[model samples]
Structure formats: structure tokens, C-alpha cells
Target chain A: MDRVPILKAGDVLLVSIQTDLEDRTVMALREDLAERIVRTGARGVVIDITAVEIVDSFIGQMLAGIAAMSQLLDARTVVVGMRPAVAITLVELGLSLGGVQTALDLETGLRLLGAGPLDGGPSEAQDRR
Target chain B: MTTQPGEQTHIVELLRSRRETALDRWTELAGAELRGRLSRGELRGELDDLLSLMLRALDGPDAEAAHDELTAALSEMSRRRARQAFTPTETAFGVFALKQVVYELVTESGSNRPRLTEELMAFSHTVDELGLLTFETYAATREQVISDQAEQLLELSTPVVKLWEGIVAVPLVGTLDSARTQVVMETLLQTLVDTGSLYAVIDITGVAAVDTEVAQHLMKTIKAARLMGAECVISGIRPQIAQTMVALGIEFGDIVSKASLADALEYLLARSGVRIVREEAG
Candidate 1:
């Protein structure tokens, strides 16, 4: 059973989905993320899906679902690193992910999460807090 | 009994002697058919070339030997005529006229009726074969010209220009077909990558009309550009096109569209934080 890892950094939880997300994985990810958000008391979530190429309506709905669910759990969701092709596919599929926030990359995502841009390289990430 | 071999040589002999007279008569007949569409000198020169080519083709050891030469010469003549705007019928007349000349010469000769009939039949067959070759080459040449023009038009219609540092504009003219859409997509995508532009504006001012299919193609193109991380704005929405869209019940959701290229450019410039300040005349 492969599950997307959710890493906690202070109040923000980082999710980088590097694999082609299957239906079951997406469902499991949604459940696992919600539980973690409640248990760890994380306030912000950044999902990096740059490696995703083809995004059908199903994946699109799942993304929006996750965003909406995370919001209910009191965590702000910002979807980051959506590849140009995936964005095009999502638009073509007529699923705009309206409620989901987006950023160009993970750094921008973290910045939008109220941490400012990564200043001292990746190693010193979230350490000041 | 004269075999096919002996009959071929005999006809070639008769044509060789009366070649000039035959050419003069054939040229007159061809000129009449063409109705002086081309200049007299050019017409005469082309006829002269055809006469010599036909003679050379016929000069080989056997009638079958002339087949290759006749094909080569006719191919060149047909291609030239096609470029010169000669009709297929007029070009074929170039070969057909010579057949009539040979027929007249064979009739006027005091030879036996049976030999004359044999020579006339063989001459007609050879001329018919040449005529067929001419038409084939003419059709091929014309098709080549048409397709070349189409390719040139496609290339000319889609011109991607870099409007700003992070913006490019494609002004589309004429109708949008699937083939043209593919070309537009490839060019826009390539331009996006090359320039690393974050915005692209597709202006359809010159497009005469838009249908559901065209709208779909536009959607795909815009979406593809968006996927490349570039914001796409469609411009040049005429009153009639807007009416048609409403009538067709087509809605382009969330896609930014403007009334003109200027407006689209202005919107992009605003988004990119580019300010255009007019300089004072010094």
C-alpha cells in the first residue's frame, strides 16, 4: 500500500505527489491528510504536482475535494508546481479547480503559506520557527 | 505481309520527309485551338520543340523504343504548359494536332490503301499515348502548385509576434480547420518555450466566421498555452461572432477574451505591470 507522505514543518504540511496518482491513492491521500491535519494541528498545506502530466476530471475533482476538506479541518490549501501541460489538461477537461489556490513552485507555495520566499537555501527551511 | 516491325519503319520514313510541312499544318491547327491565348512566337517555338521531340522519339529502332523519349518530352511539355497557364485540352491538342497532320499526309500519299490504314492506326496510337502522358503530367504539376500555395498560406496566416518581454501575440486570419489548428498549436507552444513568455494573445480579427468546431479548437489552443504556464487571451470578438456564439449556445468559461488586439495587449501589459508612458516632445 503506497501512500503519499505528509511532512510537517511547524504549522504547514508539505505534500509532493511525484507519482501518477491512482484513484485509490488519491482517496487514501485525502483520508490520511485529513487525519494528519487534525492530529498534528497543521494550519497550512502545500501540494506540489509538477511531475503530473495528464490530469483528467477525476483527479481534478479529487484535488478540489482535498482542498475543500482541508479547509473544513481549518488548514489552508495551496496547490503548487502544476505543470503547464497538466494545467492545460485540467482546463480542457472543464475542471478549473475553482476553490484551490495555486503557485508556480514549492518555494512560492510556502511563501503564499505566509513564510516568505525561502531565503537561506533548502537546508535552513522552516528551521527559524 | 509487312510485320509490325516493317510497318513502324515505313511510317517513320514518311513522317521524316514531310516533318516541316507537318509541323506548319499542326501549328496552325494548334494555334486555332488555342485561339491565340499565347503569343504567336512562343506558340511557334513550343510547336517546333514538340515536332523535333516527336521525330527524335520516333527515330529509334522500333516504335516501342520511342515510348521512353516520348514520355520524357511530353512530361517536360506538359509541366511547362501547366506553368504557362495552358488548359489541359489545349496542351493535349499539341500532340493531337500532329496526329491529324500525319493522317493527312498518309491520305495524300499514293500508297496502297491497306498500308495507309496500318500507318494511320499506328500513328494515332502513338499520339494518343503522348496525349495521355501530357494530361497526367499537367494534372500532377497543377496539384503541386495548389498544395504549395496552401502551405504558403498556412504559414502566412499564423504569425506569432513577441508583444512584450513575457507576452506573445498570434494574429489569426481566415478560417480555422483542424490541420491549421494543429499548426497554430505547435507554433504557439514552440514560441512560448523559446521566448519563455508567460502570456499569449490570439487575435481573430481577420477570421470571417466562427462555428462550434472553431470555438472548440480555440479552447484547445488556449488550454494548451495555459498548460505551458502562459495566460492566453482571445481578442477580436466582432458583434456578429458574438451573436453567433450566443445563438449557438457556446460559452467560453473563465477564458479571457477581449474585443480587440489592442485591448488584449493592454490587459496583458496591465497584468505584467508594464506601464506605457508617452514621451513629451522636446
Candidate 2:
């Protein structure tokens, strides 16, 4: 059971999954991510799954669960770098992970969390506000 | 057992002796039907090869082996003709013509009337079997061709074009069946990942109709795209399609859908912070 490493970058917690996750690993990740979110007082959490090629219903639920848990802790969760096939499988499995925010990559994920440049400066943020 | 060895030899000897006349007549009959689609020399060469194979099948001690070789030759010719777009009738005629030529030669010789008729019957049966073989091969080849074209059409119709740096569009232009929708979904999603495009526009203006199934497929595609951190906009909904969707109670549920692709692009560009300004000419 390899532990998934969670790296903290500024106010965002980045979790890049580099191996196939089992049931135990997913459970552990959920617990560990929840703990890290509160301890670091992170504003955002980014889960990079670009290297993950396979996923099942359990993993799908785990992602949604993680997002929901982070939101309660006052942190926005953005699942990033999802491979196209994995995303399609999750959709076909009826687990669209609707509650979770997604980005194309880590940088975009961070941007969605407002940790990256707003691109258009304060005017863009004010416009949205 | 239907064809006696003696009868077989007699028929084989008759064909061997008048091979020239039989070959010439066979080529003429088949070539006339083809209308120069195939060159005369090529037709003659193919007929010559088939005639020799038939003679060997009748005259040889290893009858089974020779028959296999003959059918193999017939199948090869049928397959080639099929690929060349020759009609089934034209292909079968290439084999049946030989039967006509052989019958003419047997009647012209005019020897052992009843016995010759029996031998000719056996020869005719063999030729009929070969003729039917050609039809079988021709149909198989035609089916192969049709399926290949269908697969190519599936691939050709589902092209994911990059509309902008951060945007891609899949212009679906056919009936959206499960198989085709699966293709479109996979292609669109893969393009989103490959190009890292955050915006996808599924322009269904060319789609023939919109039903519950098609609407479901479209929603599933948009949802999948969203799962990958990209937003999908359904564009090109004609007035009739819009009516059909509304009548069927198909709700897009917050997915941004615009009337035209230009509108979708405008909305996406604005969302992405791209400002398009038209300066007045001085």
C-alpha cells in the first residue's frame, strides 16, 4: 500500500497520484487529504490524476466525497489532469462527480482556486464579484 | 460417382482438342458483356488460365487436388472482379460462358450422342458449381467493401476541429446513433485533453434530428467534458430541433447552449477574458 504524497504549495494542497490506487489507498487518501486541509488551512486542494489510467465506481465516489469534505473545511477542491478516457468512463458509470470542480491541468486548477494570476487583474475579479 | 471416369476422360479429351475454339468463344462472350471495362487481352489471359485449370481437373489422376486449384482460381477471379466494381452477373458470366462454348464444341463433334450428352451433363454440373462459386466469392467481396466504406465514413464524419487556441468544435453532420455518438464523444473528449482546450462546442446544426436518445448522448458528452475541467456548449440548434427538444422534455440543465456557433464562440471568448473589438474604419 503506497501512500499518496500530498504537497502543499502556498495556500493550495496538491495531490499528484502517480500510481494505481486500491481501496485502502483511496480510503487513506481521503483521510489524509481531510487532515492536511485543516492542518495547513489551505484555501484550495488540487488532485492531479493525469497518470491515473483506470478507475472504478468506488474511486469515483471517493473523488466526490473528497470534494464535499474539503468544501466543509472551507477549501475548494479542483480535480485536475484527468485523462480523457478516465473522465469518459466516470461519466459512463453515472458518476459525473458533479460536486467537484475540474481543470485541464495543475496550473489551471490553481487558477480556478484564485491562487494563480487572475489574467485580467482586479478588474476581472471585480466584474465577477 | 455421377460422372464416370470414362465419360470424364472423353469430355476432357474433347475440351483438350478444341481448347482454342473454347477459349476464344469464352473470352468473346464474357468480354462483350463487360463492355471493355476490362481489356480484351486481360480477359483472354484469365479465360485461358481458367480453361487449363478445368481441363486438368477433369483429366488428372488427382481429381480432388485439381478441382481445388480450379475453385481457387475461380474465387481469386471473382474477388478481383468484385473489387473492380463488376456486377455479379458479369462475374458469373465469365464462368458460365465456358459451359456454352464447351456445349457448342460437343454438339459440333456429333459423336456417341447419348454418351456424349451424359458426359456433357457432368461437365455442365461442374461448370454450374464453379459458376455458383464465383457468385459466392463476389458477394463476400462486395460485403467486405461495403463494411470498409462504412467504417471509413464513421471516421470521416466525426472530425474534431480546433476552433481556437483554447477551444475545439465537433461538427456532427449525421444521424447520431449509439455507435456514432460513442465515436463523437470519444473524439471530442480526446481532443479536449490533447489540445488542453477548456471550451468545447458541439455544433449539431447538421444533425438530422433530435430525440431523447440524441439529447441524452449530447448531455453525456457535455458532462464528460466538464469532468475533465472543460466546459461544453451546445450550439447550432435549429428552430425545429429546439422545438423537438422542448417537446421531448430534454433539459440541458445549466449547460450553456447558444443558437449559433458564433454566439457560442462569442460567449466563450468573453468568459475566457478575450475581448473582440471592431474598430471603426477611419
Q: Which candidate's TM-score is highest?
A: 2
lDDT tens per residue, model 2, B90-138: 8998888878888788778877655776777888888888889899999
Q: What is the TM-score of each candidate against the true structure?
A: 0.73, 0.90
Chain A accuracy as TM-score for every candidate:
0.88, 0.89
Least accurate stretch of 10 residues (summed lDDT) in model 2 chain B?
A: B1-10
Off by over 4 Å in 1: A1-129, B1-6, B33-45, B62-66, B278-282
Model number with the top DockQ: 2
Which 10-residue window of candidate 1 chain A scores lowest in summed lDDT?
Answer: A120-129
lDDT of 1 at B128: 82
Model 1 lDDT per residue over B233-276, tens place: 99998999999999998889999999999999999888876778
- Give candidate 1's whole-model lDDT: 0.79
DockQ of 1: 0.17
